[model samples]
Target: MSLAIVDAREWQNLLDLRTGKKVKDDDPRVQAPQTATLRDVLRRHPYPGDSDPRSNRWVTDSALDLVAAYEPQLACVVYGHQYFAGRYTPMTDVQRKGMMEELFAEIDRFVARSGYEPVVVGTGDMVPLEGEIDLGKLEGLAISSHWSARYAGLHRATPRDLDHVRSLAKVERVVGRDEWLAAFPDAEAVPARVPEHLLLAEEGWTFVTTGTPMRRPVRVPGRGFRIPLSTRLGAAPSLLDIRGLVLSGAAAGKKVALIVAEGVGMNDFLLPFTPCANQTGWHYYEPGDGFYLTLSTGRHQVFAYPSGYNYLDETDEKKDLPFSGYFLDFPAHALGDDFPGKSVAAGNHSMFVHMVFGADVCMECFARNLYNQGGFGVIHRFR
Candidate 1:
């Protein structure tokens, strides 16, 4: 992946922390000179978002576009993060319901062109959890109320084969996984391991989600509410027919969610998908940082900054962006300050929403953008 975007990266000069000495690029201790730590090239790039390329649209999209451009080179299996990649035909905008038919058909075309057979797996998001593990308690960490499982490093065992999703999707494999991978090809490859698909199941019922699935209005253009799917909040859930899943789950008294296993590697993913390309001998490029950015949230602030780390922890060392200064007296006119009359923002993200928007009432879930605990929301309303 580093080699794929070599031209765009800004290779970092090395330094020995303890001795305060400069480390040469060829130093034996430098296992990965372009690692996330050393790769100043990757750290500054943003995530996928809108055309504007800020945090939501601008910041996130730049990061995502980086991935779409480079990750495919890392592995043909990635074949581009969106199904649209490797498409033999151009996509025509259609209603949401027609999307699958259009997608599957194009996927079939790519298969035919590539000399590969289509796995056409019919899958659902619903699966039962036989047991659970809490990283918060085990690791002695504080769980984010919005999405505790993420910080807690919660773990669960999903069936190696999702017979349930296949039974529903009908042909063979599960449809989608809630959490998607980062694909910023140009941005510094910010290292984000992975987060679980937000799910809550009890008494034979389960609800799994991948976007801001809490109390909020997503759309109604005529009424003056329009959330662009380009922003992290809008972009993610917009990718899938989450409404159908929620409705189906509600009707059946059972919910559907993508299932996964931890410590699983790419070899397992290769079972149904194309293998990532081997570009070592295939390509010859040198020296640039691999950026890491989370391209999944925000409306505009992302573009306002070069990377997404600003939204995570205020106390965390602020990179390219300015200090959050949470306790400092915020000017009445910070970026997202709205009506003097109480304003509210609710979604699945945790610290980010409160930090960026400064809303009077900030409600969240998907605890800290990591956990998926359900049946509630974390509401922060000013008295």
Candidate 2:
């Protein structure tokens, strides 16, 4: 579910996800209408899917900026756009740094006017609270880092790099890992990398997961009926293992497709097609706390806010940064980079199949300025 929203339309999903029913414009449940849109984040990219946010990156910062500009009598400016980029385009260094400045400026302006806390964060903070999975707390130490690299920087709405995120405030907590591995016993030892802007844990929301970290079985609003995550990751397989399987299958001249059905666990997997194993699952915090990085390269990774797409990831091809690595150098280590056969990546989730996992035919909506609309497409065919 989208944690933050400006217009009433965005709120409908929250209601729909809960009830599994269509919410009408006049539906009392959905109070926000097009007329209620806080700010018109003019779409920049033009494509069939461009209008639908699920298939493209929506200029989310514009909403936050408008709210900050409103300077309401009572309002909090918590900046975080890096989570659940259902679909997106990468950003270049110039684009990322400039927009990041705009994001921080909005927060700074709001704080100066209202004197309220500026909350910025990662996906970890919301995962547990999402109501789908429950994440209990574990122990931990110092802070950690994950952000890395710049891609086509075209179609995604998530921050391409988090380089400027840390500069916005007085540092406190350092980087580490998450709260979910309570079942493992070792997760608590990993440091928690809560960024300065995030304060949900301090507010006592039972500290779920974060763009900051992941853990426990706590719910966001409340648990749903059919959706659930497999905390019982029995013989959990690292995604890297799946990568190997795909390669082997492809080599055998078999048409391979890796379908990642979100929210559905191995226990809940009841698809008609039989998979390699009867029940197979993998946990996210394999090497450390991260997402796409863990998928492309089976190592600890994070995006740049705290990253600017640099720091701890092996994907940063330009090892110019002190912290970045060159694991992508060895195509075999990364998933799609070295696929022996034709690999095509087309998905709503940003930066994954296309950027993180290299693709031959990458199709995504054109991502331009703050917002865009017309009839332009961003499709890359790298044969």
Candidate 3:
């Protein structure tokens, strides 16, 4: 069976990331008068159009091309719509719609010639004009969330709200309604919900803990002891900390769901780990030194970062930083004893990483930019 990973991000955000050069006026490169097409601009600044290549737009088109060359059935679904109801930018709804249409058309043509289809999922209201382009005809699922707009407007929508939206869109059959409802419980609600039709189940990973657990310990290689997952109040360091759940499973040929709070940023130690394989959205990091410890035994890799919070507004001050000394206190150790000739890097700070074993044994990770009420990642194996 083929593996699929679906990620949701604002249409403009996706374009900016893929192109590496923001189309905004603030970008000096964007201001340079030229008749070059968007494609040309992207080709020139293949990485984020900045001094730092690992900035927000680190996932270049070439990376996707590489993945496609290996996984023929892979589909990267890009959802177009505002995660929250607000004037996020100076652009009006009409302007936003026009921009989306143009970008979508360019992508459609590119995919037609490339054979690797990146589905463009959008709402009915966001759909292009009748004669412009029929995005629905493409390998994508277009759903109308009009019924759930009321809840979305208040930023209080739940997974159930999204389920209702999918039902209204008439794509429930494509999404397999019964299976979705059965997979995740509607116990806690989140700010935004990506339609189930767009996402495929992540197999193997299982939830071990929900809502931070107290001083429970887990063994770390070479530590010769166990350490708590967390030790802050309520076993969490910040209010943004959603019900922390430990998902344990093999990462063999599977995709893992990631829905992190929008404002959180990774520190310097985490920067190198951004733009993970098959990942989308802004791979941001907080500015400072932090550490992460990792160990790999052939096909199996294990790593952990201290749970911390980084608010967008207060990027300067370090508040509620998860104490990383607990894990980094040990001297740098090589993995030779456990796995001869293997080397493990020592890091300081919170960051997410995905290790690709080989062509057929790659791992997928995704993070969506949305409000942080609560979130969970489930990995389901193919039947």
Highest TM-score scorer: 2
Query: For model 1, how does the per-residue alpha-carbon lDDT over 1-383 read when each residue is reduced to its tens digit?
Result: 00111112223333432232455657544444323321322334422211111212221222233223222111011111111111112334343224333333433433333332122212111112222222122222212222111111112314432333223321211112122122223322223322232122222221222222242211100110111111111112321232222223334432111111111123212233322111112110000000000111112111122211122343444232121222222223322243223333322222333333343332222121223232111112222
For each candidate, what TM-score against the reference? 0.22, 0.35, 0.24
Please provide, for model 3 over 1-70, each residue's C-alpha lDDT reduced to its tens digit, 9 standing for 90 to 100: 1111122221112112212232455543333322122223223323321112122222224323323333
Across 1-383, the per-residue lDDT of candidate 2 in tens digits comes to 10111122222122232222444656543453321232232132123333243232222233233233332221211122322221133445464345434433443443344343221211221222322211122122112222211100111112322232223232222222232223224222222222322211211122222222332222221111122112111222444344444555555554444433322222323322222221111222211123444444544343212221222334344342111122222123445556655444333332233344554333232222223222211112222
List CA RMSD, all candidates.
22.4, 21.2, 21.9
Where does candidate 1 stray beyond 4 Å? Answer: 4-94, 120-383
lDDT for each candidate structure: 0.23, 0.29, 0.22
Span of ten consecutive residues with least summed lDDT in model 3: 342-351
RMSD of 2: 21.2
Where model 3 places Cα greater than 4 Å from the true spot, the runs are 1-64, 67-71, 79-87, 117-120, 123-383
